[model samples]
Target: MALWTLFGLRQGSATTRWPAPGGDDGQADVLGMPRYHPERCGDGCSACADACPTGAIVADAAGGLEVDYSRCIACQLCVEACPDGAMTASGDWAFGVRRREDLRWAESGDPPASPAPTAGYRRSLHIRHVDAGSCNGCESELQALNNPIYNLHRLGIFFTPSPRFADLLLVTGPVTNAMIEPLKAAYEAMPEPRWVMATGTCAVSGALTGGGYAAQQGLGDILPVDVWLPGCPPNPAAIIEALLMFLDRMPQRVRGGQYGE
Candidate 1:
């Protein structure tokens, strides 16, 4: 333990100054969800939809294609399958939103305005995480938040064991049948003015494991969600951005299935 402590001291401060303007949020070369180009799509093309594992890309009623960000696992399958340049890979990963409709791709119209941040949770926020039916992928990323490199506590976000003291409920996995009652019990234990964040693609739209015998269609099937973060397992920086966005400290970057819109 003494040698390890000495090694830690020598490494100095490993935490990043991310989420601050001009700071590095890590994810330098990482490719996020695919970018959809409606103009490039062919009239009879459904290749992207056919290749998608999560049903994130589908044919609309107007003989057009629609991309839903919530169900996307960022596997880049659609990008590879598109004969045209319609579905292309991108680096736009900071996908946190207040409304579910904001995650869908629409050619026109604006998304519904999100409510202002609660006054009580501006500076500090307490989170209680529940694994409804996770595959442990999201939990692995969540554990990294406390490591020396990420150091989640520096941003005033913390995980609490007790729901009564938590300001937000962070849920993972595809809301399985067995865990539904337990998940509700945790929500009921929390005080009023509480918020819920769907932390992964499973929690956001259940990804590939949804609609089976046990799993439901993510947390929206059971709880009122204030934030929806979609990824197979979102990186640490993306998670931070989502939480901050939920607190209204950061702007929602993805709207109508487009990034930076």
Candidate 2:
């Protein structure tokens, strides 16, 4: 608690003044999305598709490329695989969903409602996270929320160690066979009006480990997932966007969207 206070004090003292309406912050270089240049591509090559571990890139018969944003792990393997600079990483990071379905690439064009409620009406969520035999990437991002940069506590989101006292269960990793029963027990232990968020590619789709001996399909096989954060290890910003979905502060993805509409 003292550490939090000291950090809070430091943040308060280090605050910067707002820039004028048209003024440049000089940090503009840090912003903007990545653009892909298809013209630089060499024809009759499928190296990018072959190199993608998740198979997010596909070459159509017409000799064009299709990148599935939802399936793309953002691992940058394709970016490196593109010898012609056809695949570039973008920084247009404003990925948010009001509906659950908007979280997927195949579900674009649907109208989604903002998932998060307006200010003063947000609910205080107590999240209980379970490892379930993960590689700890999810936990690392979860911990980032508490850091001064994210400061999830400012939005009334708290991480509690005990499932019994939690209002939401934030689960990581694929539900391994051995941990299935324990995961169920934890979900059952939570009180009424509870929510569960599956926070990784392993938890959402099982990904590479979906067919493993220890893996038990996915989290949906056990408890119903309210929100799905789709990444091998989701960025902290993605996790925050998902959390905001549960709070009803962001728009909900519409039908046929990546996340639930």
Candidate 3:
């Protein structure tokens, strides 16, 4: 134990100072959410929509293309398929949204206005995680939040086993019927001012394979979601940014399914 302690000391702190401006937040070279420039889209181009595996993009008579970020897997197929420069890779991994409609984009789609934090979560948040029917990819990233590198505790966030003590319910995966009742029960147990965050593509839109009777749709279909973060499984840095976005500590990078201003 003593030898290990010395080794630990030698290793020092690998904690990333994210959410603040300076330290390594692990965002460098990360493939983030996609951006959209309607003006750059060809007049009748529908390539991006056709190439999207999840049907997240659809041809829009008005906007040229309508994008639904909730169903987006960030495969970048749309980017590769586009002949024009409408859809480009962006530096926006923090796609946490307070309103679901913000995930959609139409030419006439107005920018989703930011909403104030309604849960009264002024400082520090304890999260209660529930996996309805995940394939375990999301869980792997969640595990990294506790590692020495991320050190999520430094940001005043914690994961608790009981919902009673939690201020936020961070859910991953489709809502399976068997887990629906239990999930509701957990929510009911939590005190008021509680918040719910759908943390991945499965939890946000239930994906393509998640529409059976055994599995309900997504978290929004079952319970109210205060935040929607969509990815096949958002990386560890994205997860932290989503959580911080929920707390109103970070600006939302996504509006109307497109990144940037």
Best by TM-score: 1
Query: What 10-residue stretch in candidate 1 is worst by lDDT?
Result: 114-123
Q: Please report the candidate that would top lDDT against the real structure.
A: 1
In candidate 3, position 43 carries an lDDT of 78
Question: Which residue pairs overlap in candidate 1's backbone?
Answer: none
lDDT of 3 by residue, 67-143 (tens): 78888888888889989888898666777787888888745555847775654567778999999888889999999
Sliding window of 10 residues with minimal summed lDDT for model 3 = 112-121
Q: After superposition, how far is residue 237 of candidate 1 from its true place, in Å?
A: 1.0
**lDDT assessment of candidate 3:** 0.83
In candidate 1, what are the lDDT values of residues 137-203, reduced to their tens digit?
Answer: 9999999999877889988999999999998999999999999999999999998889899999999
Stretches > 4 Å off in candidate 3: 61-63, 106-112, 118-120
lDDT by residue (tens digit), candidate 2, 66-104: 654434456777777888877776543333333334543
Per-residue lDDT for 192 in model 1? 85
Regions more than 4 Å wrong, model 1: 117-120
Clash count per candidate: 0, 39, 1
